[model samples]
Target chain A: MKNHFRLGLFIFITPVLLWLLLLIIVPHVELLLMSLHGKDDMGRTVWTLANYRNFFTEEIYWYTFVRTALYAVIVTILTFLVTFPVAFYITKIVSPRLSGFLTVLLLMPFWVSELVRVYGWMILLRESGVINHLLTSAGLLDAPVEMLYNDITMLMGLVYTSMLFMVVPLISSLEGMDDSLIEAAHDLGASPMTIFYRIIIPYAAPGITSGSIVVFMLALGNYLTPKLMGGKNSLWFTEQIYNEFIASFNWNQGAAFGFLLLALSSLIIWAGLKISKQQLGKALS
Target chain B: MAPVLDIQHLRKTFGDFIAVDTLNFQVEDGSFFSILGPSGCGKTTLLRMIAGFQQPTEGKLLIRGRDMSRVPPNRRPVNLVFQNLALFPMMNVRENIAFGLKRQGVGAPEISRRVDSLLERVHLSGYGNKDISQLSGGQKQRVAIARSLVLEPSLLLLDEPLGALDLKLREQMKIELKKLQADVGTTFMYITHDQSEALVMSDRVAVMHNGRFEQIDTPRNLYSNPATRFVAGFVGETNILPVRASSSAPLQVQTSFGLMLRATPVGNCQSDTLDLFIRPESIILTPAESHEDINLFPLTVQNILFDGSNTKLLATVGQSDHELLVALPQNQQFAHIGKGDTVPAGVHVDSCRCYPRGGS
Candidate 1:
């Protein structure tokens, strides 16, 4: 029995250990070392804080980073507001057969790659694309309107891309809720608005918090949606990191930006958990 | 004063199925009224209508002399304690108990005072800070009750709140609920499938079968004098015998198993055919008096089903395959009776209740 237990443990755990060490920890360690080193005056690699210091000193870098963070937060909020009702409707309002069908419908778009999905939005929203062409021909507009390459278009793409992540968790949470709780609240002299806020929202808080975190992280790290949909004005922070490594040939600066994004996002998530009074360990389960 | 609740010709039907077929009953103020029925018997539908959760397809439902047909559940003056004890899992005991009060625009201090008093009344004073998950089954049961009772509505509806507890806890909560209802002086309209719960805690019980109430009366009368065959069969353990009447004045009936029995006919038993319901405890083992009206029979002890405080004698009536369940009186005098013992058994003539065959 002991040997069997040991063998089962080895079978379950060895792959996870190998994955953490090779894929995550090893790469992160290499990036940290790369981020810490910089070329000195003599053109020799030296341990320096110059790359980290440049992020604080430069106006465009910090401004773009803050803009990216702001957009990610906005996208997260928009996704929540848009998808919360859909989750509630699917879980509580719809019949079981239709709920299943609606869930499948939600997942059908995710079958295609994210790049292709974003490109699909581009095809519809571009100046000479389907939406503008229809508007011009249908007499809604005298000329084709430039609807793409703006913050709104970019935010729309981000929310659209991350909707399923928010919705799936919200649906799971709402599904576990007992309908009797809502009735009980109503029977106890609670108004519809009061019941929604006091009962339903509190019950769905964990799902909301986790979904928001996931959507915010996705929007922050996203390069494709903002890059394609957002034209010259899209000063997303990831583009800065990409420009450092590929355009400027500065791996050290890119690595520093990457580490900074990770640290700042982690700090924001931790602060959010504190404000919402949610435990990450509890929410994940 | 008007009754706490009055339902007149209330009917609810879903598609072709009648869930609650014209329920009409009045719940007196400060009285414990219960609707007792088996699962899927439309008792829940009746309770939901009273609580304003479901609208009656047809009829008038009045609460405190006001028509509630157009009222939403939130606007009604009734609060329901759900079967699963739907306490808000996200809130602590204090917040849960204060929820209804908060919705009513009650001040914080007043809410706290009322909640604390109710918590004390439910024997959960110090447990206000505890999360709902932290409490045991019985504690949660009390919290659910307290959550509704703190509102002090015109009527409190309990939907099988004790159904989730273990046997011992259920028995314990039954007494606690009865006492709590008495102390609070609020009318309670509780519904449960458990006859014991309904009988033990309720001042009056409506025995419902299908979509209609077969009988609604005091628990003692419901047990001893059930109005219909469904109520007699569903209320408690009773030996149902298909017997034919032999006499008119005293009303004695004869069983098909070749055993003669004396029983009173309930309702109009115009037809000779009757379904007699005799309680297990009423079956007297060896009558001392020789009366002309009483019918006696010889029962051979087939088996002794010994359940402590509820021991029963499984006896075959007069060497026939017809079985009779007799409550074994636990005493030194009857201790000698065992398996395969031929004992003289007879039920009192008045104790036997008979209804017309095939009549609900």
Candidate 2:
């Protein structure tokens, strides 16, 4: 019986293990090898640290890396601030039917491709777009104002694209909270703000960590939104990696940048876990 | 002394369904008052209104002679120990107790002092640093009570706080809660669906049914002199027999089972059809030839339910086939009483109460 159980378990898990090993682990190992090598004078690949050193020596590369990290952090914080109340309202305040409807509304935008969605934002945000036309016609602006190709536009696109990821975790966590806890806080003479801080925030910490991690990773590695919205000034880290691999045909340099981006995301997530005092396992669950 | 919490004609309705209907009551200062009912009987709705969590559709709630119609829960001088004992999981025992004081903007030293003293009062002196999850069910219950009582609210509302505990723990906490209420001397408005908890813990209990209070009295009076059929059935174990008054001569009721019985009429029981409530323990079983003066009937015992001190004898009255429950007291004389034993059971007229059937 035990042997049969073991065979069944192994059979059930073999496909996932094979997929992970072949598709993810193997490629990452290949990239790691490629990142540590450079083309020699005769065009033969040889081991070197020059590819890794190039990132630190180039001022624009380092600046773009820091800018992307900072932008991702800002977007994560903004998404949290915007999504927490929306999640709370849906889970606790609204009727069940309305809450279900609102959840579907949040999910509706994800049905279309992320590329299509970013392009849609471009239409509404560009200088000659629908928003500018409406503003000028309504006498809100004398001329069409340039609303696209800026940091704000890039951040807006990042936040909008990553909203559903943040909200899902938050709603699941907030819905598990008993309403009586809020009432108990109120009864104990805690004001609304105190209740939110002392009870709701602490109870939803795992959800916050999980949501922030997802949003930050997506925003940091995002290529399409920043490319379409920020135009020339959008020097996101992923865009730099894309340029190294596709534009410049520097596979070794691109592989190094990919590892660096991976390291940066891991470091930030680790710091976030430390600061919030939440375990990654619990947060993900 | 004036009442601490006075609710007059308070009602709560959702669309067409009424949750609470014109609930009027006053909880005395330093008294443990419980609203006891089955689930969805509007007791919780009434308690929420008292705690200022929900607004009454009509009528006013007064706390310490001040109208609290506009007061929100946080502003009201009341705190609730939730049914689940909703202790803040993020805080330690001391922090949980000190939460209300901190919210009140009390000094740091004062907050610690009060938290320490409250912990001592709840018999959890050294558990200040212990996480909430580490505490057992009863300890958590005390911490919840301590958290609320530390606020020194005019009234403390306990919403079935012991409902989640196991049977043994629930029994233990009943006495603990009553003692805690006495030690704190805070007026408590407790709502629970458990009849035993209400009867054992509260100074007075209001039996509620169908969005209204059927009777509000001391536990003994409620058991002995219930005003409604719902109360008699809900409060304690009693045999309710359908009967009709032969005549209003102080007390005389004819049972529907073709047996004439005697009872003390309750309230304005002028109606012909009535409900006769006879406590099982009130019936006296004796040798066949020794019964005289009192209402006696020969019964054949069909079943003997032995439950320690609460044993009961189920029997058929005379030859009428009407089932009657008679409490078997713990005594040497009735030790041999078993199934199929024919004995004479005597029921005193005053031991039985008759209420007008389905009458308000």
Candidate 3:
């Protein structure tokens, strides 16, 4: 009976495994193959190591990559600062029904596509938009101000769009924790701030890791936000990949760029897992 | 000493649902008091109110005669060992024990000294760096106790602290807890659904039913003289026979055990319908032919069970379909008794407690 059940489960999972191989694994392999092939004038594929060499040697390529990574790091930090208190409030302080309603309100923006959401932010942040209009009318500014089409606007979009993802996991992890632990801490005479840093933060680490990884990955790959809000001169790396593949028609360079991004993300993920394991091991010990 | 804890009319309500209804009690200094009840009987809510995690809707909680109804849990000089032990999983045994001292801003050397002393006190010497999850159930329990006691709080509240332990371990810990209380000379207010656990360790037990305290007394009083039907049925084996007050002297109880029991009123309560409570062990079971001059009723034994030290006899008394559970010593007296045997059951009326029926 157990064998039959196992067989049935395997049969059900086979198609999904096949789909993952075809969609995810196959595309990754094709990218690796294209990265090994050099580009021609007619955009034909020719075998060479020039694309990889350029990625390693060029300071501009490295600069854009480093810049993109730093932006993601900043966004991750901002998201952490903004979302943690909100998650804590909803999970630990508020009534369940109210928390549920607030969570839904937070997630309501997710119903719209990222493209539309960025455009919406662009509309509000433009020089002639409501913010500048309000500022000028309130005598806070002499004329329409320039805030959009900069690094600040790009960062704002990234942080705002990813806030809910951070909150949802954090709330779950925080809520899953026993309320008695906090009471226990208080009973031991720990202050609220001490309790938050010592007990609550560590308890919610898994959620923090998950939320950060997701937000970091999205922020790292994001080209649209910077393009729409940061404008032409900012030059994020994912935009470089887009230009290489479509505008410049350099498949090998684009593939190389994509591979490097993958390697960087993988390294970060490995570091994250290592840190999580070490901390978790210490907690366990 | 006067009572270290005095809670008067402590009521807590959530919206329309009353969690605790006008609970009034006092804990004499350096005593083990237990609140014994089923789940949702407001025992935990009452404990939380005392701990200051919860504020009662009405009434006052006094610690050492100081009204602490509005005092926060952190400010209150009381500690609680949560049911799950709630040892900081991140910290080792020594760190967890030192947490309270650390919060009080004790110097590191003093903290180490105190933690080491407490570790020894709880018989956990050299387990300073042991992980919480790595400890056994009983060890965790000891760790929790050590952690709570290290603060030297005037009062300690334990919420079913032994509810998760195995039977033998629970029994062992019960003795250890009572000893710890005696050694520390602090008030312990414990909560548990286990009646035996309550009776074994508590200096006084308040039996809670619904949202009210049914009775508060010592273990002996609770078992030998339960004030209400709820208390009688909850604590131990009890046969509550429906009876009537024939007069003031002899109660007329048409029990399945036969005849009006010649019993006197236990208290001054004037009520017609009475409930005669009899513990199974209190009754004498003998063969019908050998019994003489006893308050005897002929019962046909339906089932006989040998339970190591005692023999349990399930029998039909008189013509009623009611079955009386008779416990007999598993010695030579009941060695020959088996199923389908007829026996005479006798009750010592003096030992019975008569209460007004349905007086809850």
Candidate 4:
């Protein structure tokens, strides 16, 4: 019986262990080694801090990096504000059957690929697109105005793509909460607004933190949305890393930039957890 | 003085079903009032309406003589201790207790003072900084009560808050809650399905059934003199014998097993079919005392339920299916009586209570 149990455990764990080691751990280790070295004046392999120094010394690289992080934080906050009411409506404000239907409605957009959904938005928002044509014909606007290739459009794409991640966690956490808590708060002379901040938000903090972490990571690491929507004006940090790797064939510099992004994003998350007084372990659970 | 809560002609309907049917009651100032009923009996609906979480379909609810028909729950001068206690898991004991006062824009010092005093009242004086999860079940219950009481609302509603405790804790909390209510002097509107809880705590209890209150009287009166058949059956353990009322006397009833019993008459009971209720304690074991014209019959003991003070004997009529529950005398009066022993049981006229049977 013990041997059979061991066999079952091996069957379940083998693929996961192999996948993590080969796909994630091995490649990341290789990249960390690659990131530590750069070519010398002698045009041979050498170890140097030049690759790391290049990031802080250059204004565009550091500014774009900071901009991307800030944009990601904004996207995460926007997604949370938008998804909280949607989650509350689904879990508490509606009947079970209606909430089930509403959840399906929210999930329907995600059934299509993210690229396809972004392209769908692109088709609507571009100049001479369906929106501009309808607006001009209805006399809401005199001429077609360029709406794409802007920071706002990129952030919108980022928030939209990250919304489902925020929503699922919010819904699950909100569902686990007792309705009596809200009622009890109200019974104890708490107004609706007070209850929202004191009771609902605190109860759903773990969900919010987990969702924010995911949304922030997704927004920062996103390549397609900023490139396609913001066009040439987009100075996303990942784009610069991509430029270093594919355009210039600078594998060492690309690896260094990649590690920097990873380390800095993690540092930001740590600072955020400290500021918000939430433990990552609690949020993950 | 106006009652703290006066609910008049309150009715609540959901689609085709009525939850609370045109109910009228008044909870006096500084009194402990309990609405005792089984689940789905609309006691919860009535409590929610009074708390202002729900609106009555047609009626007026007055709190301290002011109409509260249009008021929301938060605006009402009331608080509720929920069944599961609903203590904020995120906050410490002090924060949970001071939540209502904080919402009311009270000063920080005032909130702290009230919370501390209230915590002391509930016997958790120095444990204000402890997390809610750190407290035991009984302690959590006291915190939930202190959380509500700190607001000093005109009325505090408790929705079976003691139902979640263990049997021993429930028994302990029952007495503690009664004393707490007496100490606080706030009008308590407690809702529970536990008959003993209501009888032990409340100054008056409203026995609800089928969306309406069948009896709203003192606990003693409600247990001894239930106004309706539902109340009589729901309040306590009783042998309800379906019998045909005899036209020969005003309160004479003949059971289906061919036994006739006389009861103290109720006014204007004109129905021929009635349910005669006899409490288990009312049935006296034979060979003890002789009485004036009481109904006596022989019963075969089937089983002895030895539950300490509440021990009872399960018996049936001689060679018949008429079962009777006789409360065993705690004084060892029937100590020698065992199963299959034939004993005579006597029920006095006053002990036999009768209510007219209703239609299907």
Candidate 5:
């Protein structure tokens, strides 16, 4: 009877498993296969390790990989700094009516596509855009300020786009926290700053961790922001893959770049999980 | 000795609805004081105001002779054991106990000594490193006490601290709490809707109703000589009989039981309308032939129930509108009285109190 029940459960879950296998598992496996295989002049498949070897030997490729990882980390940190205070205000300080209005206002920008949001940043930061126009009119600048097509703009776009992800989880975790704990800490003679660092931060650690992980992953995989904002000077790893596949038509090189980004993201996720497990064990024990 | 904490005309209102109104009391030092009422009677609100968690709309609250109306909870020399305990889940038992000491900038060795001493005091010495979730309900209760007591706050507020425990555990904790309080000598302000818990644990209890304190007195005083109809009815079971003051005698009430009960009138009232209160245990069941006084009434036993230590009887006195719910000791034989048996019910007039109707 148990065997039959188990079989029934497996049958019920088979479709979802098949969808994952087809869309996610298969594509990743194909990417790995392509990374190992070489392409001929006519785009025919051939076996070779030349692309991987070339990638290891080149400084630019390794630099791009490191730079992208660094960009993602910076974006994650900046997003958290901005989002945590806002989430806290919404959850604790503001009146419910005002908070609900502010929540809708914060989420309004998210309704638009990430591509459009990036374009919005481009318009604001461009040489002849509103910021430059304001500066020039105010006589702060003799010419239109050259703000766009740089790493700063790219980082700004990534942070803005991924901010909502951080805020939602942070608000949820903070909202779930018992207010009595804070009051108890105060009754114990803790100052406001002490209460924040010792009690509030530790209580909301799970939200912080989960939010950072999401922001980091999203920022790392993003290609549009760097491409649009950084323009020709930008040397993001995703751009390198884009150049290899579409511009250069080098599928083998593109596959190698894809594999490297995948490996770096996986390493980060694994490290994050390890730290989370350690913190969780400490919290539980 | 001076009052440790004094609240005068304390009132709190949330928009149109009043939570606590015109509450006045003085808590003596080194004494356990309780605010007892049903839920929504503002007992917890009163405690919260005392702890500086809530500000009264109108009142003066003084702690140790200093006005603490504007003082915040943290600055006050007081600690609260929250109803849920609210122990720091991330910290171990020792860490939780040491938290307050650390906040006060106590030295490491002193913090350790205090934590260990508190753990032993609460009878959980070896469980210092255990996680909060690992401890049972009773253990959690002890940890909460240890954490609050370690701070050595002059005043400690407990909001139904043992309310979550099972009956047996709650009973045990009441005794443990009293012993702990005796050892520590901290004035504890406890809040509970459970009258028995309040009666067992407090040196004095203030009964609250409809957001105001009805009366404040010792348990025995409040039970035996309640100032209001609500207090008399709420503290324990009381049989309230509607009465009309007769012009024939001063302090004499005409009850429906066909007798003029000579009872002490509560408060000043010129009207004849009053409510006379008699405890169920105060009414004596006797044989009709043995009836002794004019206060005796002939009644028929309508029902009898065996309630563990006692048998509760439902008796009707003549053609009265209300039936009497009387409790008799299980061992006491009652003249072979069963359902439909005639009996004489003697109410001790001295034990009955007369109060103005609805003066609560």
Candidate 6:
């Protein structure tokens, strides 16, 4: 009986193991090798640190990398600030039916592909877009104002795209909280603000960490939204990586930038876990 | 002295359903008052209204002679010990106890002093630095009480705070809670569904049913003289017999088993159909022949339940299928009473209470 159980478990796990080995581990290993090598004088690939050094020496690359990280951080904070109240309302304030309806509405944006969604934002945010037309026609503006190809537009796109990821975790965490705790806090003479900060926020820390990590990673590695909405001024790190791999045919440079982005996201996630006093395993769960 | 909390005709309704129906009562200062009822009896709704968590659809609430209609929960001079003892998981024992004081803007030294003293009072003196999860169930309960009492609220509302403990712990905490209330001397309004908990801890208990108080009196009085059929069935173990009025006397009721019984009528029970409640312990077996006021009947014992100190004899009176529960005393005389024994049982006329059937 034990052998049969073991055989069933092996059969169930083999497909997943093969997929991970062939698709994820193998590609990452190739990237790691490519990132650590550079072209020799004879046009042969050889092991070198030149590709990694190039990123630090080039000011534009480093600046754009830091800028992308900072933008991702801002987008994460904005998404959290917006999603916290929304999640709380759906989970605590509304009835179950309304909560379900609101959740479905939140997920409606995901039905379309990311490329289509980014393009939809571009249509509304361009100079001759619907918003500018409304503003100019309504006498709010004398001329069409340039609303696209800026940091604000890029950040807006990032927040809008990553909202569902933040809300889902927050709703899960907030739902787990017993309503009696809030009442107990109020009974113990805690004001509304104190209750929010002391009880609600602490209870939702794991969700906040999990959501922020996801949003930050998505925003940092995002290519399509920044490209379409940010225009020429948008020098997001992923754009730089894309230029290296596809535009400039610099595979080694692109591979190095990919590793740097991974390192940066890992570092930020670790710091966030430390600051919130939450275990990574718990937060992810 | 004036009452600490006065509720006047308070009612709460959700559309057509009434959760609390015109509850009017006053809780005396420094007295342990409990509202005892089964679940869904509106006791929780009434307690929430008292704690300012729910607003009454009608009527007024007065706390210390001040109208409290507009007061929110945090602003009201009341605190609640939740059923689950909702201690903050992020705070340690000291922080949990000091939370209300800190919110009141008390000085740091004063906060620590009050928290330390409260810990001492609750018998958790050296457990200040321990996390909330580390403490046992009883310790957490004490911390929850201390956290509320430190605020010095005019009234403390305990919503079945011992319901989460095991049987042994619940019994132990009942005495512990009574002692704690006495030591603190705050007016306590406790709500619970357990009759034993209410009887053991409360100075006075209000038995509620269908969004109204069936009876409110001392535990002894409630057990001895229940005002309604619901109360008699709810407060303790009793044998309820459906009966109709008999022409023999004004208080005589004829049982369904064709036996005539007399009981002391409660209130103005003029209904033809009535209910007679006879407590198990009040029925005597093998009564003296000279006792003319006692109602005697022969019962055939079907089963003997031998619980230590609570042994009971399950028997049927006459040939009726209706079972009568009789308590056997812990004495040598009744030691040999077992199943299939036919014995004479007697209940005094004053020991049985009769109420009009279907009256709340």
Give lDDT per model, in order.
Answer: 0.90, 0.90, 0.85, 0.90, 0.85, 0.90
Model 1 C-alpha lDDT per residue in residues B134-236, reported as the tens digit of each score: 9999999999999988888899999998888999998999999999999999999989999999999989999888889898899999987888888889999
Off by over 4 Å in 1: A1-11, B245-252
Q: Return the lDDT, model 1, position A215.
A: 95
**Interface DockQ of candidate 6:** 0.78
Model 2 chain A poorest ten-residue lDDT run: A226-235
Q: What is the TM-score of each candidate against the true structure?
A: 0.96, 0.94, 0.86, 0.95, 0.91, 0.94
Clashes of each: 0, 0, 0, 0, 0, 0
DockQ of 5: 0.79
Clashes of 4: 0
- Model 4, range B1-360, lDDT digits (tens) per residue? 898998899999999999999988888999999999999999998888888888888999999999998889988899888889999999999999988888889999888888888988999999999999999999999999999898898999999999889999999999999999999899999999999999999999999888988889999999888777788899989998888888636478888988878886443457778888899998988846767767888989999999998899899988878788999878987889998999988988888987777721
Give the DockQ (C-alpha) for candidate 2: 0.85
Residue pairs clashing in model 3 are none
Task: Give every collision pair in model 4.
Answer: none
RMSD each, Å: 1.9, 2.3, 4.3, 2.2, 3.3, 2.4
- Considering every candidate listed, which one attains the maximal DockQ? 4
**lDDT, candidate 1, A1-285, per-residue tens:** 999999999999999999999999999999999999999999999999999999999999999988998899899999999999999999999999999999999999999999999989988998889999988889999998899999999999999999999999999999999998998888888888888998999899889988989999999999988989998998798999999999999999999999999987898889889988999977767
Best by TM-score: 1
Cα RMSD (Å) between model 5 and the true structure?
3.3
Query: Ranking under DockQ, best-scoring first?
Result: 4, 1, 2, 5, 6, 3
Q: Which runs in model 3 stand beyond 4 Å of their true positions? A: A1-63, A95-105, A128-146, A245-285, B250-252, B256-258, B286-294
Which residue pairs in model 6 clash with each other?
none
Alpha-carbon deviation at B279 in model 6, angstroms: 1.2
lDDT of 6 by residue, A1-285 (tens): 999999999999999999999999999999999999999999998999998899999999999988988889999999999999999999999999999999999899989988998888878878899999999999999999888898888889889999999999999999999998899888888899999999999999989989998999999889988988888988899999899999999999999999999999999888878887889898898
Candidate 5 per-residue lDDT over residues A1-285, each given as its tens digit: 999999999999999999999998998888888888986788777888878988889999988989999889999999999999999999888887898888889999999998898888878888889899898999999998778888888888889989999998888888888888988888888889999998998888878887888899898888888888888777788889999999999777898888888889879867876865535333222
Candidates sorted on TM-score, descending: 1, 4, 2, 6, 5, 3
Q: Write the per-residue lDDT of candidate 6 for residues B1-360, one digit (tens) a residue.
A: 668998899899989999888988898999999999999999988888888888899998999988999989988998889988889888899999998888889999999999999999999999999999999988999999999999998999999999999999999999999998898899899999999999999999999998999889999999987877888899989999888887534488889998888778886677778888899999999987738678888999999888978999899987888899999887767988878889988999998788788865
